[model samples]
Target chain A: MMVDQFVAQIRRLGHGVIDAVMRLGFAARFFMALILASGTGLRRFSLVVREIYFAGFMSLIIISVSGLFVGMVLGLQGYNTLQRFGSESALGVLVALSLLRELGPVVAALLFASRAGTAMTAEIGLMKSTEQLVAMDMMAVNPLARVIAPKFWAGVLSMPLLAAIFSAVGIFGGYLIGVRFIGVDAGTFWSQMQAQVSVRTDILYGVYKSFVFGVVVTAIALFEGFDAPATAEGVSRATTRTVVISSLAILVLDFVLTAFMLGGN
Target chain B: MERSTYDLWVGLFVVAGLVALLALAFKAGNLGASSIGSSYVVKANFDDVGGLKVRAPVKASGVVVGRVTSIRFDPVRYQAQVTMKIGDAYRFPRDTTASILTSGLLGDQYVGLDAGGDSVMLKNGDTIHLTQSAIVIEKLIGQFLFNKASGGGKSPSSSTAKAGGL
Candidate 1:
């Protein structure tokens, strides 16, 4: 009996692994379809505009405020540490490098996942639960093209912009703290930053990172929503899952991309 | 008309993003500004460059006059060959001294130039003759420790004076 039970458990585990692999394959296929359909969907320009308004413009205040605060904290901490070595003029380099290299993309992505990703998931989950997707199918319309594609592209396009704004505001915040509060020489702070940070290596790579993060976060949100059970409770659960999954995915992908992009340098 | 309004907003958003990107490139990377004027190439050789890197600022009396364009090893001489691109506005004498220096206590390395009293000005492709290598802190500390151990608690300054005389 014991032997039979152990064999059954092993079989179940194998099946579970296969099931997960199949689900991942399905997700990849769906993502490709979304990309393919986006070209035609772009012709429906109004829909994309509306989605961009909702996804991009709506999140600006939060991103800006958080970026400023984060920069101030970096300046304060960096000043204290650099003061120990009497190299406090390097505060700008420290703040700019930290934000451009790591913090800007990761923090903006996490915020995007929490704020907009959850909203997208919840909206789609509600539409699914209310059978609106079925109505579109019956009317011979592709819901993926009409509904999901615009939002996905909007998120993808908005991420880099948001991250840039975040870094810009953060730099201003750093200047206020480092120069005004800490009495670091303003010229040194700015010049040192310009001398050290590279356009191709630091800023452009940050944009690339945010772009990848945007796609991953939006895809997870939409996928979770579409796959949710057709119930009110399911919609809420899907929204929560979107935030949790997208946050984890953003961090993991950041690590992988950083290792690939920055390992040698 | 509504679509036009939306398109306008999108355009504005795109412009904002571009502006932010330009600001970052200007403030952090010093792009576009470098090309405002032409620069000429000059070379220097050093025994040790320490942490000096390509694109490090080349300063003359604390003002940036150029940038280090490349760093290569001269296998024959066992020295570092540094190429610099200096702005056309500044002219230096042929006997000018080039020294590798750190910005602060713990900071990035840069090339510092000291103007010489020579009447002949340096042109493009001229190699600087007098060059001082970077002071590596670890090497200095090691040397100090070695001297201290050998001298059996004698003053470090006395040993340093003797070594300099030698």
Candidate 2:
């Protein structure tokens, strides 16, 4: 009887792994379909523009405010730490590098996942639950092309832009705290930042990371919604999954990409 | 909201994002300062580069005129070969001296160019002969200690001769 129980446990684990692999395969196919259908949405440019308005413009205030606060805190903390070493002038380098290389892209993408990604999931999940997708199919209109692709494109387009704004505002906030409040020399602050931060490596790599994050976050959100079960509870679960899954994916991908970019040296 | 209003707002949003990126590139980065258009490359060799890195500023007097493009080790000569891209606007004589210099007490290292009296200007790919290697602080301290141990009576010129012998 004990051996039979052990065999049952092993079988359960194998089934769980197989289920995960199948779902991943399904997600890949869904992603391919979304890409193939994207041209239809692009042809009607207004669809993409409208989605951009919802996904990008609507999230600006939160992204900017959080960016500023994060930068200010970095400045205060960096100043305190660097002061001990008598290298307070290096505060600018610390703030700028952290924000540009890591915080700006990662935090902005996380926020994007929570704010806009959940909304996209909920909207699509609701449409699916209410049978709007089935109705579109009945009328020979592809819901993926009409509804999902525009949002995918908008999310992709907005992410790098949002991350850029976040870094820029964060730098300003750091300046306010470091140079204005803390009385570190303003010339040294700006000059040190310029001296240390390279455009190709730091800023451009950050933008690239944000762009990849946008694609990942949006795809996961859409996939979760599209794959939701046709019920209210299912829609809610998918919405929550959109936030959780995308956030985890963003973090994991960030690690992988950073290792590839910076770990060689 | 009106459709047109959405379009207008999205346009502004995109413009703002682009502006922010431009600000990052120019203000926070070395983009504006590094725009040394139409430059010529010059090479220099040194015994040691220390912590000097590629893209470090190549300054004439105190003003930056160019940037270090690359650094390579020549196994045959047991030296470091540094290539710099200098702007065509600032012409240096062929006999210009390139020395690695550190800024402030504990700051970044850069290449300092001391122009020599030569009518001929350095052209592209010309190797600078009068190059000074980076001063390692530990080596300087060791030399100081050695000088003190010897008898505190040695002239500075003799110290220089010993250093050159190394």
Q: Highest lDDT, which number? A: 2
- Tens-place lDDT digits, model 1, residues B1-166: 4777767777777677678778998987678545537888999999999999998889998888998999999999999999999999999999999999877556788999999999999999999999999977777778788978887576665554453332
Give one digit per residue, the lDDT tens place, for model 1 in A72-182. Answer: 999999999988877787789999999987888999999999888988998888888899988997899888999999999889988999899889888889999999988
Query: Which 10 successive residues of model 1 chain A have the least lDDT summed?
Result: A50-59
On a 0 to 100 scale, what is the lDDT of residue A8 in model 2? 100
User: What DockQ do the predictions score, one after another?
Assistant: 0.53, 0.75
Q: What DockQ score does model 2 reach against the true complex? A: 0.75
Top-TM-score candidate index: 2
Docking class of 2: medium
For A1-265, candidate 2 gives per-residue lDDT tens digits of 9999999999999999999999999999999999999999999988999999999999899999999999999999999999887778788899999999999999999999999999999999999989999999899999999999999999999999999999999999999999999899998899889989999999999999999999999999999999999899998999999999999999999999999889753
The TM-scores, one per candidate, come to 0.90, 0.94
